[model samples]
Target: MSRGFLPRQHGAWAMLLIPFLFGMFAAKPVWQHALLFLGWLLAYLFVYAFLQWVRTGQIRLYGRPLLLYGALLMPTGAALLWLEPGLWPLVPLFIPLFLVNCYYARRNRERSLLNDLAAVVQFSLIVFAAYELGGGSDWRLAAALFAFSVLYFTGSVFYVKTMIREKHNVKYYWVSVGYHLALLALAAICYPPGLLLPLAVLLVRAIWSPRAKLTVKQSGMLEIAYSLLITCSVLLVYAV
Candidate 1:
């Protein structure tokens, strides 16, 4: 059962995820933001506790990595509150990936999906907060960030469906990721200063994920899409 399990679980998780992302993305340098940061930390702790409760209802976890996360996160929260939005976006990221590993070990696929969804949410929040801190509202940059979110979310959905719709070929995973990378890279190549966001996207993808292989057809489609995006980008550049 591939994504047959996903539909069963996505709705409940989405309700929680939406608010978390909302809070994260809405981050700015307000004096009142400290209180909100405390709230976010509380939320993060609650989620971790919930995941643990689900994993082991008995509640006895003295894991080294968990201790490590707390050590890292305490300092990180300090940095973010001190106006280090650049690094803060990534802190929430560490927790989810650890959760993802737990999910994989348990063979609970829905948990992994939630992890990816959570990742995009955090990364988008980073982009939003980072840009705002850099200057006043740049709606154009926000739009581009949204576009990147759309592409990533859509790619993630399609990749899951492709796994379900086509059978359990995990290679399609890389295909969708590669599709996303190609699009971002082309965007960077076509537009100057476009590289930053794309590079961020690429870095997140490259660093956080384990390597996976794709099939010929998957590779071919990505290549075609990359070529097409490049061609259209060039045409638009010339037209402008």
Candidate 2:
């Protein structure tokens, strides 16, 4: 497969999969969940390729992947929607967010915090979509899971900036720490006691990981671990 066929953003894979898995586990899984995931995966690829084309104006490089992914995605997505027509309404919610991403990409500001948050919101919305796909009935739990995904991934955006893009910037480091602390506080007030453990761990990592002098790959690996921890924590707290 061409590199263009796959999304190069490693952290995005976690953002894409973890919340969907959390939602699937939160409700009763059906065979359609597999189909939903495939369509979701293809959609991400299609969007990534499209964004690359927009960013660089290198249509020749990205155009093929964009077309191929789109070709694959349309039928897969239509099939999923055909099976569960309820998903039709969720499509509109994503358009504005996608436009935000496109605007940033066109400006080559894809790393901007606002653009990152927009992507986070899109991924977080997938939690609800997956929840509904699995026949989840508890609106409260679905909404909670959506909020949790947004909160954790948004914190991740800050923490990762502190680790890499803003490593030498003291103000951004504190911003990341403060955001994580705020997340912990919010979780304590609004979430179950079981959920606090993962948030606390996230806070600890935000404080300590950058100072630990870890490499980018090490930081990424730790994030994968943290993502799993949060997923499992949510499952134990709400799904069980």
Candidate 3:
């Protein structure tokens, strides 16, 4: 397979997989969940290709991926919807968020914090879709999962900017630290004790990682570890 056939945004894979898996594990797994995940993955690939084509305006470069992923996604999506009509309600929620992404892509401002948040919200909402598909009935748990995913990924947007695009911008660094600290405070006040561990870890990294001057690969590795830790913690607190 060509490199273009795959998404180049490595961080996005975590965003894509963690919430879906979290929700799936939160409830009983059914065969339909498998189909749902396949459709979900294909949809993301299709969207990524579409956005790249929008941003670059280079049909010669992005046209193949656009056509291939879109073609693949259509059948998978149709099948999932046909099998589970319950998912229809989620379509409205996804469309606006997707349009936000497209808007930013067209303007080449895809890295803006607002655009990042829109993407985070879209990815985090997958938790609900997965939870529903898995027969999860606990609305409270599903909502909490969504909130946690959004909170973590949003902080990730700020932290990543500090480490890369805004490396020399102290204001952005402090904003990242401040955001994590606020989350820590909120966890202390309202969340379960179990959540504090992951929140504290997030805070520590938000404060220390940039100062340590880690390379992009190192930073990404740490994010993967953090994502796993958060996923495990959520499963222990809500699923088990």
Candidate 4:
């Protein structure tokens, strides 16, 4: 017998977990937010299944069970709105992004740079929502969190492109390196000094990792370690 599992989008999961954790850390965690997070995760899983269904059109891959799961999870997610009715205003804002994602999925351009940035926006929204869920009312903090997430994930897009799709493309490789360096400089000039820690690590990785000719697993493991360091640095900065 085999057990059913939720759709596993490995890279996407990392994006989801990291930003959500950062948001929770940036604000006080409460049970309601925890519940909301659980619902949000389930909702994403449902969306993943739905998108896959649209992309593949294969019932076996995402059939009745997934539909059922998505249906059941709706109320679970509705709990979040009940927790804070203020979030109701935010729902309409997502419609355009959802349409963008759907359009990309329909065209099989989900991995395109535009779509990738859209994903970054979506993930950043999760952090912003988390901040709100934690009762944070500071617009500046929310904006900062959203911008940081976008900056980090956009770099991830270039890094992944260099490693895989554009592996042999010298132009993209140099672009990735340049972007990383620019990000480091920007962090140093605009943000707290502590940000330099992870930005420097990212810069070094961009400059050196691709040249090292590491295998896919090696690259992924290195990224995970780097992400951990970035998250830790953020926590430390806020802690002090």
Candidate 5:
């Protein structure tokens, strides 16, 4: 019933969906990838519930029951190992990130820039996982997805910090703007065509959104629109 029982962060859901979709679209999906997607979804749900439990110290809402349900769902994910035993090696990769998430949740610093960057890295792993699941063998392509995800989400961290947490903090505000501009330049130089729309949209948000006196709900709506634009732009670039 509580929002914590579901994915509360729309931005995070966008991050999760875009890379997974990008990888799937980039490669050929197999039957096992369905299991992989399911497992990944359940894993995130469990992590969200667990983090909420840790942060609020309330077991009744997001505690044992949700934890138990999430743990039970993981076996289905583990079953993916049977489909492609190669997935076994990648299992342990997420453990350290889980530990880090737990640490941040405990300290109530889950939104800190460092934590956001760590999450960007962690969630970006989905691109690699999806690549492997969808029968993609090109490490280079997977790496590219990871890089774009990092750039986009890092910008997201700065955007949120500037707009909500530190709006009046002029130093961080400019830093966010500068980072967005640098990223735009880098994208233009490296992968100009594919990244054009997404980076341009990000630059606009980095410059304008933080200064707007939008309420929380309005800002959330705007973020959803931006997320969709970025997601669609990436999909379109690859589709072409």
Candidate 6:
């Protein structure tokens, strides 16, 4: 019996995070900005921890570009915490992460950082879209929204894989689409906290796949289904 969606660690992380979100969302308006900064700093901490112990022989996620990835991501996220005016602050950090995740994937040509990194980027875009829907137009807050979305979505993927040694052979489109719509809905309902549901699905999938190869027809089906579903979901949200 193969695992379907989540790793054991994801469940544990979810347990810890649920409390944090509850508190953050419950804050006063002034605290929301501070909480956003805290989230950015937490991301920096993730990189720091990844760097400090990634080479412990038991694990080795930081190498070459990822090392540089850690270097820039810390300051980039910090600057955004201070300024919160534009996406420039995050560009340096995210571009490097995205490029390197791609580089590693290309170099290794396996289920490497590329997939999860892409997931994060895509998720960030979805969060960005939420701004337009929610009638937000601030460039700075828009960027932060995108950044946190990326961090949460991609962060979930990496954490799940590292902690649980999640393995899978899959494509990512509708899953993320479902995630985007779900997040949008939650945002509409004034429950940005609900975004975790779709993300959790990805984390779970990371840990519990059979790693089976799909036939050409099956692969085509998945791709088409993903495209159609995501398009419809996004359109429906916009229409509403």
Which residue pairs come into collision in candidate 2?
none
RMSD of each: 12.4, 1.0, 1.2, 1.9, 1.9, 14.1
1-240 per-residue lDDT for model 5 (tens digits):
555577667778877777788787777777777787788777788888888888889888777658665776868866777777867777787788778888999999888777788788788888878888878888887787778878888888899888888999999999999999999898888663867877888898888888888888999998898888877887777634
Q: Rate residue 5 of model 2 by lDDT.
A: 76
Each prediction's TM-score versus the true structure: 0.38, 0.97, 0.96, 0.93, 0.91, 0.31
Residue 7 displacement in candidate 3 (angstroms): 1.9
Q: Which stretches of candidate 5 lie over 4 Å from their true place?
A: none
lDDT for position 224 in model 1: 48
Runs of candidate 6 with Cα error greater than 4 angstroms are 1-90, 102-110, 113-115, 122-214
Worst lDDT window (10 residues) for model 3?
Answer: 1-10
Top TM-score: which candidate number? 2
- TM-score of model 1 vs. true structure: 0.38
Ranking by TM-score: 2, 3, 4, 5, 1, 6
Tell me the lDDT of candidate 4.
0.79
User: Each candidate's lDDT (Cα)?
Assistant: 0.46, 0.91, 0.89, 0.79, 0.81, 0.41
lDDT of model number 3: 0.89
Q: What RMSD does model 3 have? A: 1.2
| Cα-based RMSD of candidate 6 | 14.1
Give residue 130's error in model 2 in angstroms: 1.0
Q: Which scores better on lDDT, 3 or 6?
A: 3
| Decoy 5 TM-score against native | 0.91
**Considering summed lDDT, which 10 consecutive residues are worst modelled in model 4?**
1-10
TM-score, cand. 6 vs. native: 0.31
How far off is residue 98 in model 1, in Å?
Answer: 13
Off by over 4 Å in 4: 1-5
